[model samples]
Target: MTEGRDDRGVAQTGSNARKVFIKTYGCQMNVYDSQRMGDALGSDGYQPTETMEDADLILLNTCHIREKAAEKIYSELGRIRLLKAERANEGRELRVGVAGCVAQAEGHEIIARAPAVDLVIGPQTYHRLPQALAKVARGERVVDIDHAVEDKFDHLPASQAGQIRGRGVAAFLTVQEGCDKFCTFCVVPYTRGAEVSRPLAQILEEARRLVAAGVREITLLGQNVNAWESSDAQGRAIGLGGLVRQLAEIPNLLRLRYTTSHPRDMDDALIAAHRDLPALMPYLHLPVQSGSDRILKAMNRRHTAADYLRLLDRIRAARPDIALSGDFIVGFPGETDADFEDTLTLIREVGYASAFSFKYSPRPGTPGATMEGHVDEGVKDERLQHLQALLRDQQAAFARAQVGRRMPVLIEKHGRHPGQMIGRSPFLIPVVLPASAGAIGAVAEVRIESVRPNSLMAEGAEAMPEAMRLRA
Candidate 1:
C-alpha cells in the first residue's frame, strides 16, 4: 500500500501532515466518485493512503445496492474503532467519515450507530467535504446529505486532473450522473438523485486530456448512459450520439463504448453512432432485467418485451457484427413459472455473448421490496442456476466462433504465467498471448488459435509484420 501525508487547512509540520484513506464499497460510479474525492482533498494538501491503520482521516465510500451493504459498512467501522483507540492512546487524533450511497441512505444514523464516526457525507454532498473535515477537526460531528440541482463537476476539477502515475490503453469517462427511470427494484434514483449531464465542452476537454495521457479507448459511463442529454456552453443541445461523434474526431483514440443503457433511451441518433463511428466497439450491454411484460410493468421498467426486441433489431441492423450483453432478474415480485420461461425465451432469442443474472433481492425503500408475492428461495435459486448455465453455453459458443479469425487486441498487462500477456479485443473479449514485457499498452494483431470457456488463446500473425513488432 502507498502512504503519504499532507495538510488541508491544518498547520503542516514536516513529519505530522495528515493522511486520508478512502475504502470504496461498490459499482464503477462509486469507484469514480472515490477517485474524485481523492483529487478534491489532494488540492487541499490531503494525500491518499491505502490502509486505514496509518491514516489521520479514514473514509468509507459506501454502496447501498446489495441487501447488506449498510451492515457491512457498519461492521468495518466497528473494526476501525480499535485502531482509532490505539492511535488515541499514542496521543494522535484519527477521524472517521462515511460517504456514498449508504451515507445517503442512512444519514445521521451511521453517526448514531458508530459514535466514533466524526463525519457523514452523502454522494451528492461530497463537494462539501473540505468544510465537513474542518468542522471534524474542531471536535464537531458533521452530517451533510443535501442534493444539489446544479452540476457538481463544476466545483471539482476534471476527472483526470492530477499527476499521471501510470498509463492504460483504456479509461472510463463519466458523461452523466443520476437516473430518473426509477425501476422499482433499483435504489439509484433515491441514492444518486435525478438525472444530470455535464456540458459538451467539459466532456470533450476530459476526453482530450485522457487521450493526451495515452488512453486509446474510452467508455462513457452513467446509470442510464443512453439517456444522456446536455448542451454545450453556447446552449446547443447534445446527446450521447453527438458526444460520440465529437469524441471520434480526437486523433489516436482507437475505440469508444458506453454501458447500462435503458431500452426506452435507444434512439435513432445513438444507433447512427454505432453505424457511423468505426472506432466504436461492436458490443452493447443493454440490461432488460426481466422478459415478462407483467414483471417489467411491476418493476416500473416502462418498456415491454416487444419494445426491447424491436430495439435489439435496430442495434443489430446498425452493426451486424456486434455482440450483445445483458442483465436479468430471475424472481422479481409476483413472477411466475411463465414469467421465468419468458426470460429464458428472450435469452435464447438474443443469444448474448455474456450476461449477468441475479435472483431478486429486495432493497430497502424501493417499491418492489414492499410489494407482495415474493418468490420462494428454492425456486429463485433453481431458476438462477438454469439461467446461468444457458448463458455460459451461449458465451462458450461465441468464443468458439472466434477461432480461425483475426482480432485487434490492446495489450493491457503481463499475465501471471511467465512470458504471457493479456489484452482485450474491441468487443471486450479477453485474449492471452505470449509477448515481451514491452508489449503492454500496444495494439497487436493476433490469430485466434483456441477458445476457452471465457477467453481466447492467440498468437501474433506472421502475415501482418506489424503484429509481431513489440513496442519498446
Candidate 2:
C-alpha cells in the first residue's frame, strides 16, 4: 500500500547498521515471510531502510500465483538491476536477492537472467539467509531451494522491526503452511509444499510475543487455515477452533480471525467456537472459487455448490451476525455462460459482505492450463467485469446497511489530515475518524456516519456511549 521506495520515510542510517529494504508483493503469507526475512538480516546487524537507494541488501519477496504476476516480478527485477548498477557506480554494496515462492519456482532462471541477484532462498530455506548472505559477501552467488525438513520458525530471531514497526494493530501469524488439496489451477502446493501445521506451543509462543509487541488482533494465516490441528494444554488434539478459543484467553488480545479456509475442513466444533468466541470477530473469508458443480469438479475442489451453501447455512445458524466473504474465479476453462449464471445465482443467494473475483489465469504444469476450452481473454475480461460489478454492488449495499450501527474498529494507522486516524471495521472496511495518535492499536466503538463504495466514514469513539461499546 505504501507508494514508491521511500513511502515509510525511514532514516537511511541507524547506529552504523547496514540497511535491508524488502519489497513484498502477494498474500498475507508473503507479508509474514518478508517480516521474518527482515528479522533474519536484523540478527546479522542489518536495519530496515524504506528507500532502495540506501539499502545494502534488497530482497523481492514474490508470489507465483499467476503468470502475469510472475512477469511483473521479472519487470521489477529489471528496475532493481538498473538500481544495482547505479549503486555499483557509487561504490556502494547493494546485494539484490529473491525470496519466497518465486525463488522456489525460478531461482536458477533469476540467477542466469538477472546476474545482479546474489542470493536466492526459498521460503523453507529462508532461515539460512544470514549464512547465504555470508557466502554472497565472499563473492559467490547463492541459490538454495531445497525442501528442508527443519522448522524455519525456530531458527528466526526476534524481529527488530517487530519491536519498531509492529505492522500496526493487527498482525498475521502463519500457523499452517502449504496445501494438501491439489487444485487444478493452484501452484501453492508446489511452491509452498505439502500441508504442515506448526505445533500448538510454537503458535502460542509467537502469539504471546506479538501481543507483547503491541499487536491487539492476530489473524492466523495458512493456504488452508481450517485444516490446522495440534495438541491443547491437556495433550488433547484440537482444531483451529480450539486454537482460537485458547488465543481468546490471552489478556489484551482483543480480536482473532483466520483466512482462506476450506468448506470441507469446517468442523462442527470450529463453527460452535464462532458462536462462543466473541473475540473471534464476526467475519469469515471462506473461498468458494466457483458455483458450477462441473467447474468445481474440474478444479479438483472436491465440493459441490449445494455443499458449500449447506456449510454456510450451518455456520450462519451458529453465529447469526457473522458476515461472510468469498473468493471467485470467474473464467475458468470450460466455464460456459450457464456456469457464469450459476455463479451469479449463488452470489445473490449468499449476500456476501465482500468478495474477490478474478479472471482465472492458468499456471504452468497445472491441469487447468492444458485443459481444453480455455476461456478467451476477452470473454474472461467481460465476465470478470460483470462479476466484479455485482460484487461491488453487494459490498456497497452491505456498507450502507451498517450506516446506523455501532461497530468496534481496530485503529491501524494515522490518516492524512491532522487529528485523523484510520481503523478497520470487523468486516475489514477502512473507517476514517477524527482522533489522536493514542487511538492506534485500540479497538474503539465508532458510529457509522456515511457509506462509501468500498470503505465507511465514521464518527469518533466519543460519539458512542460506554454501555453500547463492544466489550467481548
Q: Write the per-residue lDDT of candidate 2 for residues 1-472, one digit (tens) a residue.
A: 1111221223334344577899998899999888888777766667778998788789999889856876787888899889989988987778999999988888798899888889888988888888888788788999988865676656666665345354767898989988999999999988888888888888888888888878899999999999999888899999998999889999999999899899889999899999999899989999999989999999999999999999999999999888899999988999999999999999999999988878898898788899999899999999999989999888888989999888888888887554667888888888876684246888788788886555777865334445433320
In model 1, the clashing pairs are none
- Model 1 regions more than 4 Å off: 1-15, 159-167, 436-438, 460-472
Candidate 1 weakest ten by summed lDDT? 463-472
lDDT of 1 by residue, 400-454 (tens): 8899988888888776555678889777998887675248768888788887556
For every candidate structure, what is the RMSD over all alpha carbons to the true structure, in angstroms? Answer: 4.3, 6.0
What lDDT does candidate 2 reach at residue 346?
94
> After best superposition, candidate 1 residue 269: deviation in angstroms?
0.7
Report how far residue 2 has shifted in candidate 1, in Å: 12
TM-score, structure 1 vs. true: 0.92
